[model samples]
Target: MGWVACWFIPAILQVVRKHLCLRHDLRGFDGGPSACSRKGCVSLSSCSEAVSMSKVLPAADTLPTVGKKLLKGRRYGLIAHGASITSRGKLILEFLEDAGIEPPQVIFTPEHGLFGEYAYMEPVPSDEKGWRGVPIISLYGSSFESLAPPQRTLSNLDCLVFDLQDIGARYYTYLATMAISMEACARAGVQFVVLDRPNPIGLSDIEGNIPKPYLRSFVSYLDVPNRHGLTAGEVARFFAYKRGLDLDLLVVECAGLVRPMQLPDTSLPFCPPSPNINDFECALLYPGLCLLEGTNLSEGRGTTTPFKVFGAPFIEDPFAFCARLNEFGLEGVAFKPLFFVPKYDKWAGKRCGGVQAVVLDRRKIKPLLVGLCIVWTAMHIYREGFQWRREPYEFEERWLACDLLFGDETIKTLIEMATSPFEVYEYMNAQSKSFVEESRDFFIYPDSV
Candidate 1:
């Protein structure tokens, strides 16, 4: 029966893929309404017209070209990371130089540092000799207070520009950095401009529940779902409106980037926004797999396949675990038995058994749900050994790390009661849908993209 179910599941998934007009490429999935070819797949280029119609222009691209006047004589402070580049493959700093605008007086970098080389939670130093010779500050410094720029820094600039690639997850930290900067700008009376980029996972894919107010931290600043689908610019707008901050907020929107198209579908180069998020697939799984950080398991941190595969030294039967996961019939993904040894993080230098989450169709995967199931399964199967990490997580010493990541204490309660993953997912879905409806007023891209 298990063998028959395995064969039937793939056949059904193949049909579902064809019906959804998904391409066979596992790198990323494009969901534009383009006609499929004879083999029931669409080439990435074939959806160019759809992407063009979306009119997705990153803020950096528009600033020098369409919005040149805005930068004239304005001593701007840019809050950017390595992914902040023009669509034409030029660094934003280089593009500013070509446009005759003075280089930024100060540059602020978020979590992964300016070059995107630092590992997770590593303190990024402020560069006195900044990128391209401007003074650079690290928003992701050691303390919570350091997450926001000082009033003196803000007073030095007329405008603050933010351009960071958000992976559409609330816990990603970039959004929180942007929110803190927005608040600081409000206090300092500086104009906050978000040079927008694609959400990578695209828009219209909202998931998870709003973080409980008490559980809020740097990782979960806003009360939005785990996968809030708005772009960074839109998030800026939302933050301004929700907080009712009396500040000038501008979102320089993206062009030719659409909600249906993931990064791999676009002509844009894939830059790892962080060390672990190396590709679109990693980003896709990140919304859920990141929850592993709160546990003792390795979320493939040291391996080449971070987030794609996860395991622990105590996991006794990888194949059995995979088989049980398959019974859930999770869409757009399949699990395979995996064994790996990591050189760093979690069970470093130790052999571990786990499962590799192979994405069969990006269009159908619910990453948040998949991640919840994996954690719940691990807890149930390895009853005695599976333990939640009690160490300080993201600076919170007392709270359960899982509570902060899940955004509510009820999730832990639900797991303890042995509730099914589907029930938890349904609860999250109900709340997330309402959030999407409520946040529609703040959406810059009100239409599909």
Candidate 2:
């Protein structure tokens, strides 16, 4: 019976994978069959849009029909935002309604407000009368201390449910909010529940260095790599275990999620988690491109495609810069010379020359490595104009934004010393691997590879 079960399980998973590939006509980022098993799958190009994966559903939708029993006698709160919706287009509040649970006692919002309209790093103000008249507390207020829920606020609730779309990056800030809130929940004796979602960039790709302790701030709140490669629920587990939080933690995991599947592989509709991240490609490029926030360049904010394109007013030769970047022969990516003028933010109203990164093969792309190459090339070429941002970032005024983003001054110091890109790659690769091993203890999902 045991032998039969082992054979049957592998056969079933193979059949399911084949069905998903053929039924959805799922294609890789390069617009081809994602794997050799899917070679016979239909081309998605003929169709105007990719077919939705009916099998994949977020945790909100996977909650049991009689979920009211879980919340019947408990005073609970929700920490969510606009992107917290189910595959059926129902919001978190609506899913709760179907589950027969009453409205949350108090709602908490992250960096963006409930509707996700606020700009990057913009202070989100609390609403006394929020959606359906529940008061909304903003976790991202003016100060670093405001990044966590108050003890008094948690004392009012016995359980807190968290559901947010994470972009698979350490610096995204939502992960930080989840961690801080978990700690606050522990202190106040509140149960922490994470309604899990898929890591949009998938779970197989871990990158960059585990930040040093002193570099910890709102952005680098957890000692994870630049691309932590864990879903929100897994992150919650990691935090609770690492911080030794003595609190009840429950994770309502999503249904039909395979570790290797990226956002494009899912059936759920893309709701831009924030004002700038409008599409899957942007989310895919974000972990690396977001490092631009630490530089003087405009990371395509105030433009149609934020993070997809980057530039600065000082670059006089866009073509040369593109050629130089292409010379590195970075895998799965290409650079095209272009010009843009942001309506707001850095270099607003001034035409700036730069390159638009075209991701040809997402699976092969080492985003953090690509980002380091870009920064290094720019520094070498435009030494006079290039400068690290010294502005107050994420409420840490002492260290420069570049230092904070990279998690230490080592990368900055190396770049300043004109170290070889090969050396930088070796250092980052080693550190990233160490973090991946350390994080394995908390992973909730299985990986294909």
Candidate 3:
């Protein structure tokens, strides 16, 4: 009986691996029948070896050795953050200095400031005496005018280099900062370059709708999906091509990275891009969970676990709400009723009821769709208590918070009209498919190697 079990286990693993390889589009594995014998059968160790060969390293890891030549003899400005480091855990600035290149003349920081310790939307000041005495400028400020570097700032630079880690969600402001900086460089006749990084959410799973032109803000500057699954370099190229910016743009592409690979799949270290996005799970949930910002509900901002859990004081029956969510049979995630007291942000110091999203399988989770479903479910349960936040979000005061987050007014209208969440999901799925096809030309990495 024991021998039979051992023989069957290896055979089962071989079958499972074959199915997974086909589904994930992994190459080098031929899904053929394995030979097994009663005396000596294939062991689990060998099965593990079969699965390990598909991994790819991120671009940041290869940049120091392969991309350093691009920076030679150029006085450049860098738009980077704390997560802008090599896979070996060396800061990019230090790596440049070690390579005998002068550090950037001017450094620009995104939302969370240079060190990534500041709270979301916290204003960061330009520092002349910081970061090896290089002038540090904050791209994110209190107003739209502050988001872009002044023309004089870029006029003196030969190149503007952008190297921030993006989580692939639209609302994440780093991409917006890059676009704005690219445009500024174009106007100033400065060369623009991006040291590419992997899209933490992978490169194939684009989701949600593009923001309408009127609703466009810093968050929704590019007309891409809520989850644009391209790397930072690819996104820079797409933006430049779509907007017809007549600038010298160069992308130092990451070596060995391929499609359908998220951050965890790569061997690179995970540096939190912002205060709340602390892990790969948070990055996965961000596209959907971030939408909670435009609502009265707490998107778990003040809690240690932001975006992983969400609730509001109005949610009285969390168990029932979670159960209702489960009924939707959303793929790749499960919801659990939870009660939490936030120390800051919406409903601070108040106990709120909500659901904690547990990702069962990242490959199956459609974050944007799941987020819309959660919003729809909450609106249905809370009714009058549920409300879209009217406060200015991402420096856009005229547009409603939800509209700016979603990049479209129709999503809000659909939810308000009591439309089914499935209907909304179907609509978004179609939109996302079209977006993926349209944006294929800008892809630096192909879907298959």
Cα deviation of 30 in candidate 1 (Å)? 23
Alpha-carbon local distance difference test for all models: 0.77, 0.77, 0.77
TM-score of every candidate: 0.86, 0.86, 0.86
* Residue 336, candidate 2: alpha-carbon lDDT: 96
Deviating ranges (above 4 Å) for candidate 1: 1-56, 446-449
Worst 10 residues of 2 by lDDT: 17-26
> Whole-model lDDT for model 2 versus the true structure?
0.77
Measured with C-alpha atoms, the lDDT of residue 413 in candidate 1 is 56
Question: Clash number for every model?
Answer: 8, 0, 1
With a 3 Å backbone cut-off (N, CA, C), the pairs that clash in candidate 2 are: none
- Model 2 over residues 297-403: C-alpha lDDT tens digits? 88899899899888898888999999999998888899999999999998899999988999999887777767777788888899998888988998989998988
Model 1 lDDT per residue over 137-201, tens place: 99988888889999998998899988888898999999999999999999999988777788888
TM-score of candidate 2 relative to the true fold: 0.86
